[model samples]
Target: MSLEKLDLASPDLVNENIEKIAALFPNCVTESSKGKAIDFDLLKQELSDSVVEGNKERYRLEWPGKREAIVTANLPTTKTLRPVREDSVDFDNTENLYIEGDNLEVLKLLQESYLNKIKMIYIDPPYNTGKDFIYKDNFSKDEEKELLESGQTDEYKNRLITNPDTAGRYHSDWLSMMYSRLKLARNLLTQDGAVFVSIDENENHNLRKICDEIFGERNFVAELIWQKKTGSSDAKNIATITEYVIIYSKEITSLAFNQDEDAHDNARYKYKDEYYEERGPFYYDNLDRGTLGYHESLDYGIPTPNGGLAFPNGRTKKLNDGWRWKWGKKKLEWGLNNGFIEVQESSSKDCGWGVYYKIYLNVDNEGNPKKRSSPYKNIIQGILNTHASNEAKDLFNRTGIFSNPKPTNLIYNLLKIGSNENDILLDFFSGSASSAQAVLKANSEDNFRRKYIQVQIPEPTDDKSDAFKEGYNSICEIGKERIRRAAKKIKEETKADIDYGFRVYRLDESNMQDVYYKPQEYDQGQLDAFADNVKPDRTSDDLLAQVMIDWGLPLSLKIERIDIKGKEVFKVAENSLYACFDKGIDEEFAKEIANDSPLRIVFKDSGFKNDTAKTNVKQLLKQLSPETEMKVI
Candidate 1:
């Protein structure tokens, strides 16, 4: 049999890695109970004009648009924040969320609701130090399709595997793992939003390139060089001293930076002149002939203070470097009036007939007066391992488990520059959970409502290691313990009603999908008829619940079901929700459902028998329930 070439541009490339097995290869791909992979062409037809495309994949996503996206001005509501337990991941009223899952999958699920909503994101992913086991994520198009079609949904649930140095595809492995996740994470940032990734030398270079590709090169803010340690090691050929924090923005023009004014250089103000203000201190800086008022012939066309012409040599001459307005006349007048200007004293031999303008401590907060000459170069003072060891000892009540945990101050200072109080900070490769500690400490110090979402795979700790033997079996357990300790400490210090709690949302099999598909044996016609509505492992209700959770809707949202002309219709609120997942929807049932005037109505794209029926249903619903919004599931 001849093989047909697949369209390279088509999304089929996403999961078609497996080679052809037999003549019936296409039919071999089956559908899962959760409906993981359906026909992309069909989905595109259903969600026209709303599909978001990347280099190799297209995601059918929608949003409420700019009207609802805008943060409107309103009277500040009298609200006291609290840490309430939410059974689902909506995060609901809380500003922060703590989700315990593989960030890759979580980020994919978040693409719909959180697209362009995040302002700033901070993540400390695995450094790939060659020792640290990096995540091995290989979710491909074929695997996804197979999982869906077979009604077997555990396909994506692979255990974390170590990427050893012997692995030839180390860079490819790390890139593949990060590529899709970063692609999804990019959607969550606003146009002007920014992201900060923390990495050591191992993958810093790679990360910079990846971020440039994802966020665009011009949008790169800076690659900060932070001294994470003070001491030099004697073990290696060259002592590595710093780690880089890569920063990028969704839109370069939308970036906002807090200007940090530098301390005045006291050496520049050492000239002897007596003047001090009560409010603060003051100093006199000298002016040279090149200053504004120098050549009287230029502005006033008059003579110099020594009595001849304004220009030197008793004749007009060009000013040095054609300098003008070191101090304009109006500013010069103000300086003289305030006793800030000083002409050469009467008896002084080196009296240069030029004017001096006062540089005062008080200056109006206006235009970019001084552009930063260089990036921030302050070497962050990190805590010694002794200090870190002691802190970890206290947390574990013994010698620490991890050897080189970063200090809390190092992360706190980095966070201070980019993160605000209400930001949702994510730490995907949260080791020892120092980032979490920094977030809590910063929140308490400033009373900002910043929230943190940390994800660490349950990689088992070494059984021979002291940390594991001490009862922390996995790295995740240590991470959780660190968070608990950090919260307790923060609570003790701040008497405010701050929430030191975080909800743990772990990655598990989706409740809607089951492992295996076992359709009851029946006639070919019967199988075709029932297959449209009856899933092998999951029911329609399960998929609906998953959709609701993914949309950030509350799980406790009351669901009501009603029967209309032998078809089941689900209503979430009294008159708010109306979902008809029932395939082969009769025309009369559709009309009856429309007459109820629900706020929102959802129907599976395949539910209607034909395009004419779908059109009629949409047309009638608009007339009867004019205010109701319609959505295709």
Candidate 2:
């Protein structure tokens, strides 16, 4: 087989699914002359009445740019994440990632490798307050050239603008920006994964509608109310002290809420009995039911300890009606036989005796002792914005570096419920990297090896702000510093053997030169001028990054450089992949690599000594390791 270049872009999911279906049922799949277009008519006919088509009145949420939002989500990006080893901590070993770029583009770049891989995502996107910065995705134009010409970008090349309420399409612009990002983010979630988004009253309703459309209304988990603050001094009418966190699951049926052990400890299971030593604490619940609208079968009187029947009555005993036990006859008999029902003399004259059901704290359905815990509640309380602000101030040693930073505890609790040990957590809108700190702290506390990927745009800090004055030109700088500080603090405090470092990557143009993309337009003279397909400034590491992206390999995998026959060869994730991009590669070097029999190997097309040497290497690899998939860049 001849070696071919791998397309370095996100896969077209629709076409991939079509190919799978064709493989399973060849008769149901038909192709057209226009590059294998699916014959929908035959496919539908094969399925008979199992599918619905051409429904004009279907339910869907829409807005001005809804269609464009979908197009943006499907569009492939030519951007790649370039490693910044100088800015990274433990670059060779850490599984954590700190990606500085426009999150929309970053999410698209991550689609291939991270598809259905992330366990939980927690994003604190801009609440769309009038003064907050909003992203404007100009998909119609070249992003890099447009930003360079618009003068809206900082030295780091992050394109952003303040979105005021007076903007003509205030709501529409914000909605469009969120829609595309959310759509792409959903693809990275595992089947049992979930996402939590933080918002306020300004766009809570719109965000809910957008999530309903993207994640499917059936997957809507809960709308959590967080008591962000105790008071709002600048209120016009009502003092708004709460914000919302909308939760959605990839598949609701597969998601389960983790139990809160601390909450279970404070439960009111105070009663003790003869079996308390074995059954643990117990609580008494009322067994009597109201007579009004009561069923006759449930109205039978319950026997009292005083040899009398208990009946339902008003406080003054003005109306005496037949009483009903909360449990049916068989259940009551079971409870009585198991000593779970108790009758005691009542203090009130209205009822001579009280019937009660015993609920044991550590008991199973069969009334045997078992450990139990409580499910976390939707309403999260006691976490205030002031706490988050204090944390930011303490971390930065200054005030106003970042505003309204989320508390690490809040994100820590969310991570606890949404993720398990070793699962991947993502936060695309990672302002100030609070989620990163939370992940680090959680891993240390629980002795877990969980991984995190944080994406944040290097939005320029205000010139007069404290952060800018402190040498932090962009929010990304402040976020990266926070992670370093948090990692050091967590290590010193916990002394845990957990990963407290992250790998740093920045988004940029693909490593391939422009000529590589438009090879057909170049004449022989032009092609000869561009001998190397890769860009001039890109290093061997940059080319390897693109290779990983094209091959759908995790970017955090361990990479090592080894000398083979006095030529440097890069090995990634052990034997998973090997590459040699050095010049003057000979048959001896190629044969040495072939003897290793790696799963995959790549070489620079121009690095070989001659065509005869390349042919010799290929033949040797085919004979020695026929199973190895080899490619040339």
Candidate 3:
């Protein structure tokens, strides 16, 4: 039996949406010339409670390139990630990933492996300051001089098409760029996940509108004000100092962030008792409290230290009370039996006693320590932009390597709020790799591991900058070096055991040749001209990586190169998948792999001796590893 060829491509969003719609309303789905499609007229009628109005005026955000941007999100990319072993810290073991590529294409490739897996996403994208370039520039294969002359890139071939105010479609272009990426990003968030975006005044309002449309207005969490600086002296009317960090949850009902850390004066809690070991320390307060209402049950008396009866505020009579004991009668008795209530002697009063209660520093409620946390405030301060620049300088040991890098503390704070032990954190527009440093630091502090995936475009640096002078030619180079250096520093200072390694993968064209995808357009003789389906320079590692992505397996999974009787084979995540692309295979090789019993396996079609050998190999696997799903390239 001829094995099925593995479909090496990203998830087709259009088809996935059709299947989802069909599951809800089957009659709204219909067959189109291309494939399965949603019948819009039927879908519209099914969604409406009354007669469907096809073209009524409604509230919706629109732009010139909106339609094209929506199409881009639904389309699959022809690119794949190729592993970079030399740059990777721990390629074989680490769960963290540092991907280098255009984030739009990278987001598409990750749609399958990371669908509903990422717990938190924090992106600091281009703020659209008219001088800043957007990420929508498409790179072409022209010469460097030609690209520079056409204003598509800079001297270093950096994708730097600026969107100045003079351009007619200024906001439209920015919206289109953000709209498509946000649409793709939402699918990757877990049910309890959320995304945070930072923006300045230049495009804050526009970004809010886009996020509202994408994440739904009801799911909007908070517009946190980050005091980026002390003040901007260059401002004409008012000094600008704050920026907005908009947040939205995937499902508002399911998500809940951690409360802020405890903020209290330790000195106040000074007194101690026998229970101080668990309760920390204590302070005393008057036992009597003014009543909000006249509850006669609460107005009770207590026996003093001098063997005297002490009523509420030393009142002997049960007058219509404006005062009462803070605790109820049962709770007051429990406190008296415990070491919580304090009765002291007085000179003049007939009761001759003072009643007070002990409050513990670490609260002891029914013999349990209360959780130490407070509601987090929406206004963030003190972490300034200068701190971010200073961090870059400290890490690089040189100035001007990067400008306006986000402070690692900011991400550390976000990690506390949004992540827990072993939760996945992602930052697509990772600059200077501060988020990676933050995750590493957070893990070290608590010894709770959290895996992170960072994505960035390799935008080149200016020649005059200190980063370029130090041989860091691109932003990705600086970002990667930051992680390496930061990991060492964190390990030395903190002496905390944590995972400080990450796998590196660079985006590139697919490993397959043109004929592999377009065999129908070529004659059999023309197809015969190509020696193999894969490209000439591609290696077994390259094919394995792409195959894992196509099979919806993570790139960070543990991969082992097992030698099966001189044939090179890759066993991913201990038999979740097994692949051998080497040639010269027979039933003996298939039987060896079948003995291990992998859940899924793939091989090169040309690996077998002949058609007869391929048929026997499948038959052997059927008898030995019946559960294995076999495919070929």
RMSD per prediction, one decimal?
20.3, 17.4, 15.1
Best by TM-score: 3
Candidate 3 local lDDT, 1-633, one digit each (tens): 658987788888888888999999999988879988888988899988889867778888888989888887888877889999899998899999999888888999999999999999999988988887786533445555676778776443445567998889898888988998899999999999999898899889989889999999988998888888887779999998888888999999998787654322343568877755778787787777552455788877787766667766666656665776767878878888887887777565674566788878677636567676556653255788788788877877766787578888877877778888788888999978989999998888756779999999888877988888899888899999999999988987875668888999988888988877778899989888776688989999889989988998988899999899798999999989999988877898988889899999998877787889889988899899999999888
User: Model 2 lDDT vs. the true structure?
Assistant: 0.81
* lDDT, candidates in the order shown: 0.57, 0.81, 0.83
Clashes of 3: 0
TM-score of each: 0.54, 0.78, 0.81
Best by the lDDT measure: 3
Model 1 lDDT per residue over 28-112, tens place: 3446684323444544444467663533444422222211111111111111111223432233333345455556555544544
In candidate 1, how many Å is residue 466 off? 3.1
Cα displacement (angstroms), candidate 3, residue 204, comes to 1.4
Mark the regions of model 3 whose C-alpha exceeds 4 Å error after superposition.
Answer: 30-32, 137-160, 262-373, 377-379
Ranking of all candidate structures by their TM-score, best first:
3, 2, 1
